[model samples]
Target: MCEACSSATRGFLAAGDCEGLTSLVEEVEFTSHWSYEDDSNNDSTNASNDSVRNRSMVETRVPRYWSWHQQSGEGSFVPSPDLNGWMLTIDAQNLSVGYHYRLCLDVDGVGTMQGYGYTGVKAFVSPVKATDVDLPLPRARDAELQLSCPLGPSGASAFLATSCDTTLPATTRVTSLGEVRTASVPVLSAGSASACSVMLDTAHLPGGRHFTLCVGVAGSGASLGMIGLPALGDALVKVYVTPISAFTSPRGHGVVLLGQNEKLFITCSRCTGSSEVFISSGACFVGLASANSSFKSTPTFASLLLGSSSQWEAVLDTSAMPAGQAYRLCVDLDGHIDSTLGPGDSGQFVRISGVLAVSATGLAASRVTVPLQCSGCSTSTAAYLSSSCSVGPLDVISGPLRDAPVSMALDGMGGFTVTPGISGLELFRHYDLCVDLDGIGTVSESFFSGHSVFLSGLLQVLGFSTVFKAPAQPISLSCSGCIDTSKAYLGLSCGGAGGFAAALGATAKAAPTTVIRTSGTSELLSVDAALLDAGKHYVLCWQQYEQCGPGMV
Candidate 1:
């Protein structure tokens, strides 16, 4: 093997220089060497001696010269004069593998520099090598163990061995030579050629025990001196059991209103050990719907385990209990009664009431009757009328007339009716009538209607002149057939010619006068005399839309 002087040695060489020719001679002689051999055969050896003697005579006569020298065969030397350093190269073909070598350099006046000595300087051919091992931490249900091993030049095979002892047999050994084992570990080239891995099925190993793993190689076992697998004392070989961590269904807590044949779902964290789930209502675990003398008979319900061990379902029939009543529910693990569910109310039952139909009598000139029908309501509950169902003051209908007293009445059954007077009510106006059996807090629905104005009798002018002089002041006119005093008005046309043409044409030419409204069957119209002309005959008429009373002139 070849070697070069380290930087520290080169620094010493560069700082120290030969002073004179004598120093140069010393340095050159220090780097040179000679070899001699003895010949045993006499006849041919004498001939070689004669040739050697002749060569010696020529060498002695010539002047001797000295310079930096290098050994022949398997090595070379290159000098860097500027750097005062030299490098040596050696052909390693003839060297044996796994052996260390040391090189020494002698410089005149600089002492000797050596490599691979007791100072930890050395190089070896074909050093033993291996890849990192990836052993898995044993688990309860794990079915297989996978790992990787080093591949060698000649290829390799691998195996997995298990032992119950804390420490397995020695992974490495020597033939009195402390070199590592030259075993070739198997390579899994189908996946990665450089990195070989192996998978071992561990189903045969018993659970809940400690085990050690030993990895070994074949093919190049003798070349690699020793093997050391990773520590396996911490490996656990037991079966895995999933634990029940928490509950998921029925939420944290609240009331669950279960109707007839309605299913209640219960969920929990997955667990494989136990498959049974149990449900109970009273103190002890009683059959679903078991009869109790103190309380009402509990309804028999059906339960089923759904999907995996995480969920269960129970359905309620509710046929034994009356509607509108409340019940409490409780739950627990199948056999673990001490482990109660989360805090707060576990469950409850609530019956809902509904309105079937709501009707009202036709809104008439005098009154309106609202009739309501509902389910799950008592005879004492009366219906109320309001614009909205929001809890607040209600606009309830009262007494006989539009301005009468306010009251409500219900029949013995769920039906009820309220007749409120419409005397003061505005005709042809829509009203939203909302009825609640138990007021806004309970059940209710809304109805709508518009008050209709009826012309019961013919429109008649009670007091008017067929012909009259224009009055100095407005005249008081009256009518008897108007629907109501508030909705009725009167008009007159005067200061025109006589005859039906004059009467019909006069109305078109004159603007009608409005009359003050009053609360009675008859309305009095006051005509403005200033709107009339003197010495003119006029025709008077009573009109509610196109229905006009017999024209008066």
Candidate 2:
């Protein structure tokens, strides 16, 4: 027998396996190192030096090996050789089911190798349980699902399934799958780990309906669990309407007037597909027709179908409505009332014939002019200025003359101007100036209603005198007929045959004359009539020295 065969047979006999002992000897061959690296120098010493370093490193390192065994009682096997010659062992009792693994070897002298046989075993994979799930409202148009499961040797994946039919199972409509990922760190003491989350875009789905959601692994589908969400309403779309203004009657131009029937033009933002548009005026509702529609009716009031454009025009009749009554315009969409677009008096009719503004004019004895502005007032409307706001026996100031009739001149643009000449008016005195619209209505609601405006600071002249006497006794006298009291003096004269003569000198007359001063251009004086002849015709006079025209007696 060959020397290698004899040695193998003897080893088998010693191990008590001599009955089936078979021996064979073959020389092992290895590829030359020159094929892996350049050895053009043919230097054996360099090769020997490299081998020595590698061998020393292999000897100092601790060896590790992977052992795989079959749990079906097929015996254990170390499929890979250890670089440091370490021994490997496998116990079948610790192996699990439904898992397969292979061994890898890193030999010191040889290259890396893989085991030819695979070990199949069973592993305990905790059932996938959905810890929590969150889905957005139907209007939000998005879906999200979260789940958790036991950390298995191979981590699990999750997916989201949605169905429009709430009665059907969600798994039937698998819309999206969770991304694959490795086993994550344990989140709880129960060894439960969070799986990959699932997300779905629901923007394309119709709103206002119920939907079902299911979370599960890729292979398990929705078997893990399922949830239901209530029906959601559609998202709100903002709506806005432009302001409406009255239109001119014959000219058909836009204007603002009170209690006048005129066409109204309106513009708005189109937010929905509804062709029927309704406009609300306070508690009243009116159907509006689009300007482009062919529907035609009486010019008093009519409606048009709104076309593709956002503009709408209609005729409003205010013959039956009172002046100063405000109107509100509101839009209704699919039974949804949108009041935000309509503010107070957005479509109010023109109740005022014209607006009035009063201002003072002139220097001393001042005068005032009132400007009445009207956009689309009737030609028959009459405007005038009045002292009182009452109706009967109106105290109206018509012209620049004080006694002239109160009247306003129309500027042909629904406006009027009235400049009243107020003479003999007391300075610094307030007089109410009001504008009355006779045919149309009172412009009292305007800002210029009966405003107390007048000019002041004018010079005035006045004179007065009083006499007091006791029968058969001395008579007392008082006089006020001077502009400057400092220059004023009381003069006395006794009746004489030729004429009355000065009874006292000017200096002596000042003693009896008590000058009383005032704020105006007049002065007062008091003197005792006893200073003159009693029971005699006497003349008393108040006079300013240089500025006096004549002394009054």
Kindly report the root-mean-square deviation of model 1 from the true structure over all alpha carbons: 34.6
**TM-scores, all models, native as reference:** 0.19, 0.20
Model 1 stretches with alpha carbons more than 4 Å out: 1-289, 292-313, 332-376, 382-553
Runs in model 2 with CA error above 4 Å? 1-353, 356-366, 376-405, 410-415, 420-553
Task: For residue 437, give model 1's deviation from the true position in Å.
Answer: 10
- The candidate maximizing TM-score is 2
**Residue 65, model 2: Cα distance from true site in angstroms:** 99
> Model 1: per-residue lDDT, tens digit, 1-553?
2244442331111101212111211222233334444343345656754645433221113324332211112233456543566554554443223222233333221444332122223333221232122222222223233333223212323223333222332223211111111122332443443333433333343221223333322222222211112111212221121122223333111112223453455443432232223222332223333454222323332244655655555554444343222333333233232232211112232222233344532233333555655444444333333222222223354532233322346765657555544455433232333333344332222121111112113234455443233332233434333443222212343222122333345443234445454545544454544445556654454344333322333
